[model samples]
Target: MKSLPRLSPTSYALLGLLARGPATAYELNNIMQTSMLRVFWPRADSHIYSEPKKLLSHGLVSEEKEKVKGRDRTNFTITAAGRDALAAWLAEPDAATHRNQAEFMLKVILAEGGSPDDIKATLARALETTRTETRMAIAGIQHIIDSPEAGVRKGMPWNGMAANLMADILIARLRWAEYATEAAAAVPDDSDRAAKEDIGLAAYQRALQRLQAELDP
Candidate 1:
């Protein structure tokens, strides 16, 4: 099979969502607003509308036109080429460059220049958002556990695992936000490069420990 041209992570995101089902640009904007997409890897709605043309250039997706009450209605569909590309992506290692968009680097990068108060405020806003997400994720898991989907009605068998994964991710992010908030608050404005290196090193060690614990076999 001819290799489909590589697409941006955002383009891949659009194609992957389309693979689930045909959607209008408006519907996709709604999807982007609710999930982790809404937070870490947020894409503007305009990008969603534009990527389809690029996907079309690469033979990845198609658009269909309909009329709703005398208005033009355009819906996008993933093509066979798109499905093939998505499958190839899923089979590869997820340790890709796209992971850095998570915004955690803001704490370390913006350690200086801005007023400490401003840095604190930026982090506070992000922390509050993550905390709310953490709560929503917890509530969703509770709702699922209190009544299994299969037991309740016609529902997916493997969906519980997906929900659990989401809950675990949000919990991890919440813990990170909590820790970063404190760490950022601890460092003073006049700290020199050496001191900031120490902070970065300490964070790296902690992350290493966490990874080791998770990967213990």
Candidate 2:
């Protein structure tokens, strides 16, 4: 049996989208831009435009061409092999212990190099973004519940579950940002290293307590 090509997470993400239905790359890019994929698995438009061709080369997806307005449009659909590959990827165990939030967290970690206002602004932006995302996620769930047709409703159990997870993470981030923003604002300009360490220790303790509570039955 021929081995499947080693695919990146982005490749699998595209395959998952194709599994839903046939779509032109433009349609897929729009979906990525406007849907939960934007929040969960964002990619650059250039990458989105090009990945379909790679999937086609790997025989994971098939392209159908048609003429619209005398212009060639290509639609991609996942092949049987694509479905098998996706299933296999899903079945593989995820070794990651935590979700990566390096982009924002890195700023948080290195905030001492900047002023307290800088960190506060970072936290404020995170808070706002996560709040918006949380609202969008809830709205998405409500849409799925209220949709008349089965097309949007077809995702059912899995989609709902995934949305719930997304909302949970967003809410967690929102809460963290709120707390961090408040704490950063409270920091005194004259605070010495020991004072800052004390503040950080307190924050760590609070987090530990929260984690312990969560772990409790």
Candidate 3:
């Protein structure tokens, strides 16, 4: 038997969305735009439009067309093979090499090359964005609770778990951004490089202690 082609993460994301029910690419894009999926696996509109076709070719999804108001509309639904693939993917252990690809995080990692003000501005932007996301996450959770029969609420325990995780991550990012902003503001003059190093070292030590406590507790 021929081995199946390796699917990209985007393919799996689309399959996961279809697993909920049939949806057009437009519907999938709308869901990604408005939900925690956007927070985790954001993709371009074009990619969303095209990935479903690829899944269909791979025999993982089936497509149907209907006339709605005299215009053809296409919807994609997960096939049995797609469900098995998604289940196997979910069962696989998370790759240890996985790293955050957030641009703001990249800037933070490279902040030493930039001026203090530049780093401070990046942190400010990140904090503001995270605050907005946190609000949306809270609103989403509230919506789920308010409308138990809504389509988005179909995945009972998993929906709640995913929403809670997104909210927790956003809260953690908000806290980190606040701390980094404060630390940037406290940077001493160039002449006191030692003091700056001390500040960075202290922050590192605090993080290390937190990890150690988590491991022990």
Which candidate has the top score in lDDT?
2
Task: Rank by TM-score, highest first.
Answer: 2, 3, 1
> Please, what is the TM-score per model?
0.65, 0.89, 0.87
What does candidate 2's lDDT look like per residue over 1-217, in tens digits? Answer: 8898999888888888888889999998988887777767778899889999999999999999999999999989999999999999988998856445448889999988998778888888888878877777778778878887877875567877777667777877887888888888889988999998999899899989989998994
lDDT of 2 at 6: 95
Better of 1 and 2 by TM-score: 2
lDDT-sorted candidate list, best first: 2, 3, 1
Per-residue C-alpha lDDT of model 1 across residues 1-217, encoded as one tens digit per residue: 6866977778877777887789888877777776545544677778777777888878888889999999998888999889989888868776654354645456547647667787777777778988888787667556656874453322245455556666666777778778878888898877888998898899899999989998993
State the C-alpha lDDT per candidate: 0.74, 0.85, 0.84
Displacement of residue 216 (Cα, Å) in model 2 is 3.6
Q: Positional deviation of 47 in candidate 3, in angstroms? A: 2.6
Better of 1 and 2 by lDDT: 2
Decoy 1 TM-score against native = 0.65
Candidate 2 lands at a TM-score of: 0.89
lDDT of 1 at 145: 62
lDDT by residue (148-217, candidate 3, tens digit) is 5768487778877777767777878999999988888878546377887788789999999999999997
- Which residue pairs collide, candidate 2? none
Which segments of candidate 1 are over 4 A away from where they belong?
1-3, 36-41, 91-98, 102-104, 136-165, 180-217
Q: What is the lDDT of residue 106 in candidate 2?
A: 94
